[model samples]
Target: MAALLGPVITPEGPLTGQLAGDPFHPDTKHAAKALAQVVEALLRAVIGWLYRLALLWVMVDIVSFPHDDRPAALT
Candidate 1:
C-alpha cells in the first residue's frame, strides 16, 4: 500500500527543488532535494497508512511481573 501511495502523493507537488527559503549550495542542492523527496514520500506513506487503518494511537499499559521485587532474575 505504501509503495503505491508514496509515489502518487509525493510527486503531486514539486519535490526536486530547493528548500522553501534557504536554498542549498549549488553542489549540495541536488543531494538535498533528493533526500527531501525520499523523506517526504516515506512520511506521507507512513502517515497515510496509519490514518487509513484507524491506528493513530491505541492505548497501551505496561505491567511488570515478579511484583514482589526480590532482585530481578538477572540479579
Candidate 2:
C-alpha cells in the first residue's frame, strides 16, 4: 500500500493512500479525532439549547398564568 502510493506529504499530514498499514498509511487519526470532537461539541450545544428552551417555556407559562391565592369565599 505505502509502496504503491508512495510518500505524499500535505499540509494536513502525510498520506500513503491506505487507511492502515505497517509503515505507510494515510494519517487520518487527527482528522477523525477532530471530527469526533466537533460532533460531540455540537451535540452538547444542541442539548443545552433544548434544555434552555424548555426552561423558557416553563417560565413563560408561569408568568402568563398566575396562580390565584385567595379564600374561596373572599372572591
Task: State the local distance difference test value for candidate 2.
Answer: 0.75
Off by over 4 Å in 2: 1-7, 10-15, 19-26, 69-74
Worst 10 residues of 2 by lDDT: 19-28
- Residue 44 alpha-carbon offset, candidate 1, angstroms: 0.2
Quote each prediction's TM-score.
0.39, 0.59
Clashing pairs in 2: none
> Which regions of candidate 1 are displaced past 4 Å?
1-24, 55-75
RMSD of each: 15.5, 5.3
Model 1 local distance difference test score: 0.59
TM-score of 1: 0.39
- Candidate number of the best lDDT: 2
lDDT of 2 by residue, 4-54 (tens): 777777776674446344333334566677789999999999999999999
After TM-score superposition, the amount by which residue 11's alpha carbon in candidate 2 deviates from its true location, in angstroms, is 10
